[model samples]
Target: MSVSSAIPTAILTGFLGAGKTSLLNSLLKDPMLANACVVINEFGEVGIDHLLVEKSDENIIELANGCLCCTIRGDLINTLTDLLARRDAGSIKAFDRVVIETTGLADPAPVLHALVRDEFLLNRLRLEGVITVVDAVNGWATLDAHPEAIKQVAVADRIVLTKLDLLHGVEGEDKMFAIIGRLRKLNPTARLLATHRGEATAERLFNMGLFDAAKKTPQVQAWLNDEALSKVHRHHHDVSRHDAHIRSFSLRDERAISPEGLEVFFAMLAAHHGENLLRMKGVIKLADEPDKPLAVHAVQHVFHPPLRLASWPDGKAETRLVFIVRDIPKQVIEELFSAFTDQLQGDAMTDKTLSLSRT
Candidate 1:
């Protein structure tokens, strides 16, 4: 389904004690997000975030601002499907958007995979983007110690830096700057927003998907963020060796690729190196229809059905892919892509030559 046709769903995640609840509370109260339905996922048996709202027996809470909140009972798919059913039946307030708050220790890839790959969810919901909350005071230490914390930052579209208000004096300022530098290294494409003095607001966080909410048009450049990725790649050595395990990079090709070649490339990547791939998103210029670029997305091994745009957003007909991965070398992916696409081009030329000889 095209992104514009589905509900824009945002995933809110953070490390332990990163103040995700504070951000969620603030976001839910925003007038722009008044029609949003939130699904809160907690690690343990008892979920705490939803308790802040007025409770109901069915684990669903109705906020005074016309927002709805529900805790995941067993399966996330079940929870979302139920919400859709309720809205359609007029049993619940219809929500135009969804904000899913994941547990502190959760890996967000699975949640994204479900949203993109699920047959039912794909038609009803579109992945808006990931909003990761980072605690500025302890963020550097947390990232160093926990891989989950690092992954959260790596896959974020927007990184919210919390606890800046608590920082004081020159030492605190230095520490804050250092953390921001590290965040840029981990994920340069994500927009870093400080929550100090109420800077991080709903206006800055949502509707960052394939289509811009305000314009109702494709925002390919913003969604791809290739410019930021390219800048990071230029200063690749500036990133610490300790951070070598996780890296973000972009690949571009001016040549159009056949449908078969594209299939083989993705299949091999997923089957062999899926675990290392954190997230992949790109716009492809297909050989069959070069003008109608195809937007592709994948989380780990699962991929979203490619959506064809009406036209290239920037009027530049080229293929560009951005990847956030763990322990997957850029050279490896580049070689694999080249082998399939180039070989297919050669075969096509040879067939054309054979047809000319017969004529």
Candidate 2:
């Protein structure tokens, strides 16, 4: 299939009891998601019948809104391949997009790897973004106890704050803001929305890749959120103990980076610190292609082959990279890039450092 025809897929992930299923059910109710298909992956052997739908096949369910609901039978790849085959055979409804709801404890990186690195699925499905559901009431405690929860927020493109209604009075208000601050420190670039206020709509959650859904234009700036990250970096005091390990930062270079330099930097990064690098998205100014900047994305060591945009989205010729990492220092990344491009100027190359100062 052609790249344009590849179905956009979004992964919905969060910690155990973070309300991932509830948020997904709410999203599926929207008429805008009528053409969307959902692949639910539960932890155990027996899948939970949590979705509000009628069972049509053994594993496939037919939603009233014309959406298909299927549980992962063996693995994600097999389920997706089967869905595509059935769609091609006119055995099932054709879906414009796919939403994979992973088990609460699941790390979204491996799931992202399948969609990105898989040879066949690469041409068929495009990973649009990751929507992580954060429970406002218990989110603070959960993040403190579970490192998985921190990773979920770190890699998210859109974080939906759920269960805010339970956080009522002045004390609750204080708690709510504290958790929000922690989430921002972990991933400042991700768009944070509250589900209780009706903000987590299909319009805001999906199609969060490189382009705006309605305008069909590149929303590079919105996707990168470099400006917002910079703002959060200014105030790094009172770092939370839970979020001390997870860091979000940005790196920028005014000079055009050589193709070889860019490649070596990524290689060294993936080789040494790939495990800590949770998520990365950037717009690069290649020395050879000055006018057409390359848009790049990576989940850990796996990177989506860079796409050449028609022109710079923000009309800027500089390279900007935003990272949500665990225990990876800003200086280490800066030195790696400097070694390649000879553009390192000590701490000047580091645009924003959200890493914990103490630990």
Candidate 3:
């Protein structure tokens, strides 16, 4: 049921005053994103940032709810479905990709879950990556006060530092670099970039290794580095106190998972901890498809459709998953994965027994 031409979607998130709208505007100006579709979510009152985007046609839809992750599940799905229909009908110029601009205070996990867990849309889309914006001037304080901000950074594939223009001559550059260092400590897999008033180039932002559908050496190296950082930060207590409620962890094993088992695992996870599961992304070796590793990426419970790569990147034939969760312990997730794997093995054994008895 997988479609070959499904477009990639990227989620853009940040804390309050991170300049996401400004960045979106800059990205729209690029010819590469000329055919890209955008979904912008606002907190309290819907503002005029939608009007500011000049290059793209007016297809802006606002999520009036506090955050798309919490309140706009139905609306989000229906809207995306409708957009796809229109693209199919050729009503709008065919868009190459979609970008979701989350509210300043939004938690990106649920939004990702919606993309991945939906049965109808699972085969129609792919999650490119998460791009989080951090305000250079107020990021440290925001991370300290708001647990959401920490979760945003923990799950980001790319972190953009904004408002450097305002930091001129105010001892801001040092503080910004310090924040970037902290971010690297939090999630070393994420690449950091600086932008002035969201004036970053689109080439530097989109198509970030998510759509290759093949094993790439750079991506494998990045994943390995991310694994190393996660191990190092697990013992670092100073960083833990800054956002005590949020944490990031990785799960890996040499065994391949059955598709049914994987589905059951994700369904149970979404049902039990959808609110706390901020982001999850990984490469898995499925039992039926050992030669082709499946890439799974999700925010909250929403997941983009699983993609099959041409070959294993770096020849690592293991399953590795990274999670950014809020108030969810690493041990809890580890135990959950263990229990699921055990159950899957038991089920297979019982099926084998039944077949032997029938014979």
Candidate 4:
């Protein structure tokens, strides 16, 4: 649904030496994340200690191109506070978006939470998305050895697999596939991209968050990744480890859903499995407004108001909702919706499979 535009912001994170810097350098060179202010953990000054704030001028570095990069000389909150003040005052160039690159071992939740903790920031900044980088060669080992890597993958909206060119032997190739399997098990909803030598397009990376996006039909289809989600859905549960317990599934409805029923369904999800819900978005037929389908999305416990499109995209009639969740079972969602409206037809499984309970 289209809402008041907040300046889009993205968090870039990965395990140590996971090509995060290379991605940041590449983004700085591009015009895609346009008119953006970047907050980075690294900027030539070698850090000496943890919890010790480095002292430096909080001056904004104007890139050769038209963008601003703020090196964090102090804590992230202080840096953001100063940057906002500078932008307001005429000390720095105006920017419409922001990108924050976290330290290799940093947990992303706190960084995201920081943006929301302050009411002023909540009004000014929108936590757009999380992009995590993984080195293909070392990725499998990294995931296995470090709990941080799994958490990073689990929270990401986009996961970039780097250093594919370095993978040579058949063994290495197999390992790469194995890594992909692990990623899918951890977070199936995230769009995965493979880049070698850091090559990608603006549309492929930027303007992804629903708030800033124009909400074109094609991008919606790409975000859903219906075919890939279905392919990954068949056998992901077998591999869900203790820490990496996540799954994705889609629902379909032949009968139109009334607005009241829709509201009840969303409320049930929030009250029942809010914490486990990662992302949910879909365009579906509404009984009240059948010709004008509705699009809705929710992240964690926050559900945005539904948007009714002028017309259905691509003349697709089936109502669909794709969910990327952590530990919430498919049957739980299915039964809840069925309780409110007509029997829900889960697109990801057969009738028998949909009846199965969460293990």
lDDT of candidate model 3 versus the reference: 0.68
Q: Which window of ten consecutive residues has the lowest lDDT sum in model 4?
A: 45-54
Task: Please give, for residues 1-359, the per-residue lDDT of candidate 1 as tens digits.
Answer: 55566888999999989999788878877899888888987424223355345646476778777888888878899889999999999999989999998888988988888787679998889887899999998988888788889889988999999999888999999999889888898888888898876778998898777653324335666888888976763445434544658888888888888898788778878887888888898898899999988888888999887878878878899888999888787877876676655664677644543332222
lDDT tens string, model 3, 47-98? 4354442343344432221111111334678878877787789865567778
Error in Å for residue 312 of model 2 = 0.6
List ranges where model 2 is wrong by over 4 Å.
43-52, 211-218, 233-240, 343-359
lDDT for model 2 comes to 0.81
Model 2 / residue 149 / CA error / Å: 0.4
Name the 10 consecutive residues with the lowest summed lDDT in model 1.
350-359
When 2 and 3 are scored with lDDT, the better candidate is 2
Instruction: Give the poorly placed runs of model 4, Cα more than 4 Å off.
Output: 1-6, 41-59, 71-85, 106-128, 211-215, 236-244, 304-308, 343-359
TM-score for predicted model 4 compared with the true structure: 0.76
For candidate 2, lDDT tens digit of each residue in 27-127?
A: 88888798888898842422334455655787788887788888887878888999999998999989989999888888899899888877888888878
lDDT of 1: 0.81
Q: What is the Å distance of residue 44 in model 1 from its true position?
A: 9.2
| Candidates by TM-score, descending order | 2, 1, 4, 3
How do all models score by TM-score? 0.89, 0.90, 0.76, 0.76
lDDT of 4 by residue, 333-355 (tens): 87666654553455542343334
Q: lDDT per prediction?
A: 0.81, 0.81, 0.68, 0.70
